[model samples]
Target: MKLAATAGGGLFLGFSWTGSLASALEVVSDTAIAAGEINFNSYLALSPDGIVTILSPNPELGQNIKTSFPMIVAEELDADWTKVKVVQAPLDTNKFERQVTGGSGAVPHSWERLRKAGATARHMLLEAAAKRWKVSAGTLRTENGFVLNPANGKKLSYGELATEASKVPVPENVKLKDPKDFKLIGTAVRNVDNHEMITGKPLYGLDFYKDGMLFAMIQRPTAFGLKLKSVDATAAKAMPGIVDVVTFKNNVAVVGKSTWQVSKARKALKVQYEAEAALESSADHDRIFKELLNSTDATVRRKDGDVEAAFKSAAKVIKSEYQCPFLSHSPMEPMNFFAHVRPDGVELVGPTQTPERARDQVAELLKIAPEKVTVQLTRLGGGFGRRLSADFALEAAELSSIIKAPVKVIWSREDDMTGGTYRPAVRYRFEAALDAKGNMIGYKLRGVGMNSGNPTREDNFPSGAVDNLLIDSVEHKSPITTGPWRAPITNFLAFAEQSFIDEVAHAAGKDPVQFRLELLDKAKKSPVGEIKYDIDRMRGVINLAAEKSGWGKKKGVAQGFSVYFSHRSYVAQVGEVELKDNKPVIKKIYAAADCGMVVNLSGANQQVRGGIVDGLGHAMYSNLTFKNGAPEQENFNSYRLIRMKEIPEVDVHFVHNGIDPTGLGEPALPPTGGAVANAIFKATGKRLRNQPFAEQEELKTV
Candidate 1:
């Protein structure tokens, strides 16, 4: 590997990658003179000193896109990994595609594009080196920031060739390296921002501050179905550090010099809110679920063979219902955004999962052109799919426009928890029929949810495995707002489906592992319909998980296993539980996944581990319920979260493959609930049909 080359010391480093800082965050650095950096493309910049600047186009939500995405560019560019500096790219739709980071779509969508960007830059450097050496371009190969000629001992650093490479014509397409040659791709690279984060450096949205920016806090409607009717902010306006108090469509905003002042002043405002419609409680949601289950008005997603005949002829039938509560995203950092809105344009700087949509939403609200809005993204403290919506961003933009000055809006933890857009509470019913010999004959699923669209994964798993299978979905609209959770419907659906599969296995008097394997064999050999999951990949993960955990071999340990395919990936998990004081306690979990080629081993491991913890925690202790259109739990005191004491060791493994990468951020999560539920049943002889397993009376301790 060649050393990292630089463009030259004290040369111009001032190239506007995005645009001028149009808002109050107009701090300046870099650029001593003419920009010496060579713009190979929108994503890669080469300095004469052999420094490679790689732009990460997607938002980073601790899923490690910032580190992993740039690894792809560095891998193909043959740049020294230690010298490659990754910077978060601003929202530039013209140069980057798919800036959003949900559905685990970032890597799959940008894999080819990023590889091409690096390959193209490498090609230009080869041409430049060849011209300098007076040799054929094919004779030059790049390695660690250098173009080396094997026939001759001559080599040129990327820094030395940067100036000449800038003049070379970029090819229409460049060859990407074969997967076997990947250097940085699968390597365990540390997060670039780890030092800054551990040192408490300013990086997240909450840390953002400008010279003349004012802080604002909003007082929204207390209830979901209510709206602000009147506001008396006379006292709030008189408070110290208070700047202005204004009302928007549904809430009142208190602007002040600091967060503490705004927080205190917002409490002083007397706001009157009135119900715009009937206020429904958690009980109403429960009744709605029951109504939808019995109602014939359902959309049939998949149908195969004769379900009625199979059920009628079956010697035994097993039926079970599973329920999951609505959940708050509850990121470590509360919702916030910085907005500098002027008559001509707007500047939005904050932590958001969807920057383009945020700019678009603000543009629509203000009746301005999309180009008039510029969004600068900050490192997020956490998202968990919460930042996908632009509600917080819109609040800041609206308040900034009203105040006619740069402003940052912050949401109190209570405001963040009770705010709308929750993971919808859902109910699922599963029924399976078995013949006299205990051979599975039929399978059926009914999903009912509030504000859920196509709550059923009709094409997955047993849909193709069973001889007779049916899947149906019923969506009951409510005043409550709902959007995509981490794994969307699969978060709860997989738990219900996998647990029911386990129950059927037990009813058939077959080993749970053997039962799932048999089903997968059926799906692979003579599938009833088109199977969306790769049977080979799914089998790979399941077998890997079983082997790693020594399935059915651990003594005195209750074990449960679950496998699921979602977000274009397959994951299998084995949960081990131990009995303490006659109560089931989770001890450890083994997870195996096949998400194709991993970008970074360290990041991938952490993502899988984090997902496992998140899924298990929610299933074990988290629940959100509403009373009279208001959330019963506004903060952590009433709400529950997975604590350090409950978090067990999570062992992660991945199938070794060079196949193109799929999604990894959310796939490992969906099956964890089912695995834990199965393990608990083995330990305590109790079936947990609802989320917050600890809250169930049957299991004394979960």
Candidate 2:
């Protein structure tokens, strides 16, 4: 990519396939890029009206990257935040290599590059001002989009120097501002699109429209291991607004003029599915998982000192089993995509987390090169790892290709809930051996879950945290499709592991927080195998949370504490619960996170709050079960989500360390389940080994 002057004397940042600006030029424009706007490479642009537009390459899924990313650029550029505008960049692999946004690495991945881009612009502007004023470039300083000559107290706006700055040679190296001098970052900046969002503007995938766009809904098989056998759409075709009925390999689609008509026509159609064999049920999964947990044939993921000898010589041993059910992503905006497939190429518009992968999938399906597919991302209502699959976008492309027109496929809440690709059900058996001093001597974990293979992530917490540790995993084969949900394996593992740690603390007659601190200290001083976690960071958050929560001083309310590290971030959470009518009612949650340097304090706080609420909701009531290969829960009525009334006020704190930012989207979530579960145990004296804690019989008893 290279910067060039536009025909209107404005700057243009042109992208080329060969990196050489002379060949294969493409200039993509969006609403954020006004006519005659001065472009500064792929990330930044300046207009004559003093509007600094920053291009955000990553898709925004409520993580506030739309606001935070531009803040990074504006801070380095010395551009006024009030004058900065963030726009979503069109997907260009040659310019921005990775357009995906699932791992919460957008800020970390783009930090240096974006800062450099901004600094480069600042340097060029300084050079232009120096040439005009015949002064030393080093003597000039930029502040809020103005280059100041402190010697004479003279200043010039960036817009005034745009033309001359574009002619200045791009600097190969530029000095970045010190973090201590940062003004925009580490401060609370409201989302740039907050106005658009609250005003109900057209921003999401469902809001996209065309002159003759058709609506489509698919009639998917109810069972997991079933295929569409036959579909009779005789009555559906005769219905009002119905355009046509088409059948794919696995599903039948009802096409119409509107989403409501298509949905109604889908219900009128008669469909049948053929199961390959006896459909697997939740009972079968449980039985197989239990058997596999006990089976000797297992993969040994991690093995340290002799666990057998430690257990044999231990003064006491504790054993427990924990199970978590499958979960759905359940983003507020259900899966929907608009696709226009021509003979030459395909154009897709939607809210997907992985657009590059989706583009490749569409290209492959159409027997064309990957470049033939173009995917434009929209503001996502919610994407808790479900949008990473790209199946919905591919589905829209398939239907559009068949119809030879632009079609939008919309999935109802029922379709999103029962459709495949869910969080896998997992079972964990934990064994802890304690010596006479109440110190945990040995630890063993047997995890059984379904994935393409085993979903057990061996490197999860309490792995390197223990010395005499043995981690084994067993896989149970099933027809149920599963994918990443939020924190993935860590989501369930943290709950089971941390809750078991609380039990160990209770057995040792020690405070949960104290016990965890001791273990973290041990892991820090006397290391084990490949400690991927930062013990100091973990202890920092734990101590901060304990101090902030007034952990041991609370009366009348039972408190539970849990700390976990994932996605290179450490988090500790404490939950306060009160028993009412033989049920545990959560009152508040205290969360401490160490996600390196926070980008947007307000956005980071909201992320932690949302994560804690999401984790609690899933643990307390969310569950997915299958009977005869069909999902038991169809919608919100059956698959329960924590309502506003059930949500507790989350108090968030972050460790103020000057480290590079890690992931914030998922790290705050893992500890919430364990904290809530431990709190329930303290309140009702019941060990809730299974998830959906509301269904526990112990809690049901008065």
To one decimal, what is the Cα RMSD in angstroms of model 2 from the true structure? 3.3
- Top lDDT hit: 1
- Tens digit of per-residue lDDT, candidate 2, span 575-638: 9999777667899999999999998999999999999988999998998998999999999889
Off by over 4 Å in 2: 1-8, 13-35
* Tens digits of per-residue lDDT for model 1, 549-579: 9999989999999999999999999999999
Candidate 1: clashing pairs of residues: 5-49, 5-50, 6-48, 6-49, 6-50, 7-47, 7-48, 7-49, 12-34, 12-35
Angstrom error at residue 168, model 2: 1.3
Worst 10 residues of 1 by lDDT: 1-10
Best by TM-score: 1
For each candidate, give its TM-score against the true structure: 0.96, 0.95
